[model samples]
Target: MNTLLFCIQNETDAMTALVEVLGQEQTALTQAPSLPLMEEINAVMQRKNQLIASISQLGHTRKNELTRLGFKHPETSMPEWLQDQAQVECWAKLMKLTRKAKELNRVNGLLITKHLIRNQSTLQVLYQNHGSTSTPSLYGANGQSNTQRSTVRGFIAI
Candidate 1:
């Protein structure tokens, strides 16, 4: 009983705090974006924080309600802010960026193949001049003895 009361108090306090913060954020978002873009950036950050807090509080409340007589992980429904198209678009863009990076990496591997083919004759001549008998048949920049290369891996990749 005592623990329940404590949790109730905490839950009420957190709900009130989140509501206040969200109200302030809504007001701020409604106001004009400040000059220089930095202010808008900061406001966006603040709003994000507020949204997180609100979602956390709502989750906690829902969890408390559904919790067994003891332990709780706390369940939560979706937050209102997430219903916005901009939020969905942001998530989509992040996913797209990951895909683009993968495509770029694939292209880099193909370019490395081309580079190995183009440099094979020169590498063979250099190996002969140095009297090194072991110059592995190079294919796709991979069989080359990387011991002579720098400690960095894929150093040229952005």
Candidate 2:
């Protein structure tokens, strides 16, 4: 029981850290994309991954402890096995933290999706303009007009 409580508390702490990192990710996603911001987001993601792994390990340890204590199905029997008030409270706190982390992660995923959509839209527009006859051809690496070697013209010939 003592070990279970300790494991639960550790899981909760890791979840708290995860939520914090997710918040940072959310903030970074909301900002305009830049080289430095992208670097920061990458760092936040790395930390988030580490926290998630720690939380998963702690959860497994807690479940194993419950099994050792004679709970047939640790997940469903955890509440019942938590006879002590402190144990119950710790479990509840861990549950609450888990919920928070999940919500933050969901929101972060949505933000990332939004960014991808925006980027795709921009790329589509660029492609359309590049293929348009009225649009001027861009200069090639050798400082010559790319009109003669246009991909749209080459595709049409093929």
lDDT of 2 by residue, 10-33 (tens): 888888888889999999999999
lDDT of 2 at 4: 76
Each model's backbone clash number = 0, 0
| TM-scores of the candidates in the order shown | 0.30, 0.82
lDDT of 2: 0.82
The digit string of per-residue lDDT tens for model 1 on 18-131 reads 444444444444445456444754674576466556546744664565465433443332232234565455434434544543454455456546656756865665454333
Model 1 ranges off by over 4 Å? 36-158
lDDT of 1: 0.48
lDDT to native, each model:
0.48, 0.82
